[model samples]
Target chain A: EDQVTQSPEALRLQEGESSSLNCSYTVSGLRGLFWYRQDPGKGPEFLFTLYSAGEEKEKERLKATLTKKESFLHITAPKPEDSATYLCAVQAPKDSNYQLIWGAGTKLIIKP
Target chain B: SAVISQKPSRDICQRGTSLTIQCQVDSQVTMMFWYRQQPGQSLTLIATANQGSEATYESGFVIDKFPISRPNLTFSTLTVSNMSPEDSSIYLCSVKVQLSTDTQYFGPGTRLTVL
Candidate 1:
């Protein structure tokens, strides 16, 4: 079965500290990989989409890179406001309904 | 990106009662989806709400247990029937805008608490 797994279920960092979250997926005919940021009691906000290996996207202090087996979301000098659960999802071309296999998400906390 | 909204931002219901969550999008989206998130867990796809057609439910989800209706391109409703404590979860709706077909934007979500 196709699956997506994220590493470091929870992480804590002081303000300005940098870190990276990992999302490893095992699926055939990978179509796209997406990143999202979600705050408490709210729905997820779209961040970036990576379609091919070596592709990278950036927004503010966050950058996402994709590879064949995994994707990494790197946070550079994160602030407390950047604290939230980062989610990863992948889409397979075979599924006609455009279903997304989601990861468990990594809860990152940046404390000042 | 599309702006999506859900009615009943949060609600507390009794066991055995049912609740219907509504999802609305600002644009005429091509696809709408429903998802569930249990406490401390990841999101699970419930079904795909196709306009003017029966919803396509995911594995382990049944139409009778969680019925979905899409009356138009921009509106949909998901009803949780015969609710139980196990049904207590955050129900979310997402849309894939026609302009951005590859990405999905989510609504604020409906938080349901069953007791």
Candidate 2:
């Protein structure tokens, strides 16, 4: 079975603090890993996509890195405005309809 | 990247009633999907809306309860039939532009509250 698990269900950090969220997965054949940021009452916004191990992508203060079995989303000097639920999803070879297996997501709070 | 829009950002409806959510894209997309999200939970795929064909539903979902329509390449609709309190959730629409890639862009979801 292909599944995705995100750790640290919720995190509280002071402004300017940095942390990394983990997204571990078990899939037969990994096609791609995606990261998204969703705010309250809004849809998720695309952040990054990591296709292979040792691959990384960055946007503003966020960086996403991928491995064989997991992916990490690192936040640098996060501000209060950066607080949101971070979602992780993966595409596997078995999903012929282009469906993605999703994780529960990590709720991040940046207290000023 | 594609721009997507969903109608009726939030609504309050009585149980046994139904609500139809519309999703429109700025450009023609190859794939469109509907998802349901409970508060503080992960997204669950409801179905895939295919243009000019019947929508493909997921394992736990059915067409009768959640009918979908894809009239063209850039527009689709998802109707929640005989909605119940358990159906109170955020229904989202997403689109994938390219088949070779796996990035999906989402629209501002419709927040449904059933009484």
Candidate 3:
């Protein structure tokens, strides 16, 4: 069975504080790992996609890195505006299915 | 990235009534998907809407309960039939863009409350 697990269900940090959220997975084959930021009562916004091990992508103050078994979303100098639920998902290439296995998500609270 | 929109941002409906949510994409996409998010929970895919074929429902979901329609590459609809209080959730429409390695773009979502 393919499963995704995210650690630290919730976190609170002051403005400018930096931290990393972890997403571990168990799958048949890893095709892609996706990162998304979702605000309360709103849909998730796409952030980054890491395709292979050691791959890394960044947007603004957010960075995402992937390995064979897990991925990490690192927030740098986070602001209150960055406070939201961060989700991680994995897509299996061999499955040829449109479905994505998702993690429960890490709720991040950035206090200014 | 594709721009997606969903209708009826939030609605409170009586139990046993049905609600149809519409999803429109700015650009044509290969696949459109529907998802359900219970309060404070992660997303769970409901079905995959294909352009010319019947929607493919995920396990634990059925077409009879949640009928879906994909009229074209850019539009789709999901109807929640026989609604119940447990059906109260945030329903999202997503599209898989051709470029960027099949990444999905989601709409603002329809918040449904069944009472």
Candidate 4:
């Protein structure tokens, strides 16, 4: 079965701290990996999509990179406003159906 | 990016009752999906709402439990039948405008609590 796993279920970072969140996935045929930021009591907001190994995307102070086995979300000098849950999801090729395999998500708290 | 909206932002319900959540998108989208999320847990795809067709449910979900209706390209409804304590969750609706980008825009979500 295809699955997506995110590491460090919870993290606490002081303002300006830089860190990286990990999302490891095992799929029959990888199509795309997505990153999202979800604030409390709200739906997820789109972040980045990595299609292949070595692909990278950036937004503001955040960057996402993908490899064959895993994807990483790197936060640079995060602010208190950056505190939120980061979600990772993977999509398999057409053969695996159109469902997206989602990770448990990483809850990051940045305190000032 | 598409803007999605869901009715009944949050609700408290009694067990055995049912609730129908509505999802609307600002623009006509090609794909619409429904998901359930327990507190502090990951999202589980319930089904894909296809316009003018029956929804495609996931492995653990059934059409009888999560009946979905897509009357048009920009509107859909998901009815949770025979609710229980286990059914208490945050339901979200998402839209995909373009398949090539693989980007999904989500609505505010409906938080349901069954007692």
Instruction: Give fnat of each prediction, in order.
Output: 0.85, 0.94, 0.67, 0.79
Question: Which should have the higher DockQ, number 1 or number 2?
Answer: 2
Q: Write the per-residue lDDT of candidate 4 for residues A17-105, one digit (tens) a residue.
A: 99999999999888899999999999999999899999999999999999999999999999999999999999886554555889999
* lDDT of model 3 at position A42: 91
Instruction: Tell me how candidate 4 scores on lDDT.
Output: 0.93
Ranking according to DockQ, highest score first:
2, 1, 4, 3
Candidate with the larger DockQ of 2 and 3? 2
Residue ranges of candidate 4 with Cα displaced over 4 Å:
A94-96
Best by DockQ: 2
lDDT of 3 by residue, A1-112 (tens): 8899998899999999999999999988887899999999899999998889999999999999988999999999999999999999998744455348899999999999
Q: Which ranges in model 3 have alpha carbons more than 4 Å from their true place?
A: A93-98
Please give, for residues A62-101, the per-residue lDDT of candidate 2 as tens digits: 9999999999999999999999999999988754544589
Instruction: List the candidate 1 regions with Cα displacement exceeding 4 Å.
Output: A94-97
- lDDT scores in order: 0.93, 0.93, 0.92, 0.93
Q: Which pairs of residues collide in candidate 3? A: none
Q: Is the docking of candidate 3 incorrect, acceptable, medium or high quality?
A: high
lDDT of 2 by residue, B1-115 (tens): 9999999899999999989999999999978999999988989999988898899898989999999999999999999999999999999999999877789999999999999
Alpha-carbon error at A107 in model 2, in Å?
A: 0.5
Clashes of 3: 0
In the range B66-100, model 4's lDDT, one tens digit per residue, is 99999999999999999999999999999889867
Minimal lDDT window, size 10, model 3 chain A: A91-100
